[model samples]
Target: MKFPSLFSPLKVGPYQLQHRVVMAPLTRMRAEKPSLAPRPLNVEYYAQRATPGGLIIAEASPVVNTGFGSPGIPGIYSEQQIAGWRKVVDAVHAKGGIIFLQLWHVGRVSHSSFQPGGALPVAPSAVAISSEFKAMTAEGKVVEYETPRALETSEIPGVIDAYREGAKNALKAGFDGVEIHGANGYLIEQFLQSRSNLRTDQYGGSIENRVRFLMDVTKAVIEVWGANRVGVRLSPYGIANGSGEADPMPLYSHAIKSLDPLGLAYLHFIEPRSSGAGRAEVNHQNVPSAMVLYRPMWSGVLITAGGFTGETADAAIAAGHADAIAFGRIFISNPDLPRRLRRAYPITPYNRATFYGGEQKGYTDYPAHDEMAQA
Candidate 1:
């Protein structure tokens, strides 16, 4: 039951991570101000779990003003925001932990309130997605999803530049690396799936055309933080935020093949099928070869996430299935998750309440093993 395999040093692009336990990026809207930036509380929350040899991908932060779809979510487009994130990055590094900022753009999965001056949401096509997002409305909160303004062919480069600017800001903020949030039915993902993208331009239509947006974003980010410091999160079969791919295998194969040349730090993909109890099952035909297919395509590290536990993660690494594994909810409830996994300690269930907005009740108050034992 030893995790020596998991504890082994591994190289990701240009940086070396101490262990394979990565804290997956999870949304926790706790920024002090809606349009401002991360505050001391956010810094404290991350710093508390900054364990040696572990990697923490911070919560998804918007890359541009129009890309923001949630209130109180951090952004990397402003100078003040960079300074705010610097504190968090420095705090984590001071504790001997590696941190990455997940740059994001929500596309049409946003409300008018989340956009600038209450403008309409923007996307690849003018078509309105059946998927709706929660936002603050004048008459209290609502789930009204508005039709988005389709981006003209000329305006696409500006969107790519937003990711580059966010990457630059991440470096200024002292992050070890940057992870482009291309998964979970976000902007980059929306462009990849035919269901969301109805454009007939170079950015949409054929598989190569549909994958153009993701490629542009990745290349732009590489310019800011060298390809070695960049990573991408993709969900081939992810069903969140109103997404369904008619044909994902060939679509992703083309996309990953194009991205392989970038030599990114790592390409993290959500296992197409996963059990709720942290077990991965290859149940989808669209994602051919899984990690095997991706390894040959991308010359950098390959990490797998979604519903993985300590035992499962170790097995995957030992079997050469993945270089590393990321944990989401487990890390939320157990900051010392790596240590607990080492000893096979019983994990305390996470409280459903206080997951999003609330005091630090269930956020950072979870005690470590020794504290629990003493209590």
Candidate 2:
């Protein structure tokens, strides 16, 4: 078969996948109102892309009310939200696809308008992000991010508890597993990187201290879903959401060594060039591939994302760099992406304008390859 490595079956934790193509977590923001529940539209959207034997990591969902980074972003902290996710899980399962929910907390990337009682967002340190960030308010208005408050050391346990509870809720929602959103300048990334986390307490300073929060949350979630079913995502060169480290190799290398013994499902890494958020002004040509830096330290399954096409993805797996590849935009436009890639068919480009906060037009209206041919 063409792209033999890409089309080969691989084992991830307890489950065996038919192919190595994974649906990356892409935020479309089509969830239902005030409750931030996954709506019927979400079910149809995911179901359409739920190619049997492929794995799908659903979009990022806040673990608590204060963790919200945008309007219409789904949450797993409520009973209604759990029910909403159950529908999504059931839809994907019906199509014989395995799905995982991405647990997230935006941390300092949020605004006071998205917080309760107009409270400022919280982070490991009081240091305000120096980059530009826009968030949708509760009233449907978009505004710039406000300076965030430094989280008290005593309050740190509460954040870990939120992740534990979210994992439990994901189980109740019938998800096969949960992926900790530790990348893209979110809460976990905020704590891992030096620029965003300036705390002198046990949660910051040295690389060991900086990674404490990530370890705590991972342990907590692993308690709910075993380490074999848990995965962590990291963006070593990510400058998105205004979080970047002056020297990240040592920090992430240390972090991976620490997590290696956990026997986790997989370590997901976003490639440097493919970070869709913000860019660091410094030249990134010297930054090495995450696989090259992390493969020796981590022996478990590795999933690499960011700007990989069919040919490149196959090349990555063939070169023994990664076990699987996650496609974000490609899966968005091509619901039957595996079949398209296997057959070497042309793909339909997605409409960037209607990507977020939209109806069925850009969300579920994209026709499958066969449907397009019949049209």
What is the clash count for each candidate, in the order shown? 1, 0
Give residue 349's error in model 2 in angstroms.
1.0
Residue 135's lDDT within candidate 2 is 57
User: 43 in model 1: Cα distance from truth in Å?
Assistant: 0.9
| Tens digit of per-residue lDDT, candidate 1, span 75-173 | 888888898899999999898888998999989877787666878888887766673434444223767577888888899998898888888889988
lDDT of 2 by residue, 205-318 (tens): 999999999999999999999999999999888777777889998999989999889999999998876665322223245557887678888989999987778898999998
Clashing pairs in 2: none
Give candidate 2's TM-score: 0.96
| C-alpha lDDT of residue 232 in model 2 | 93
Residue 374 shift from truth in candidate 1, angstroms: 1.8
* Candidate 1 Cα lDDT to native: 0.79
In candidate 2, how many clashes are counted? 0
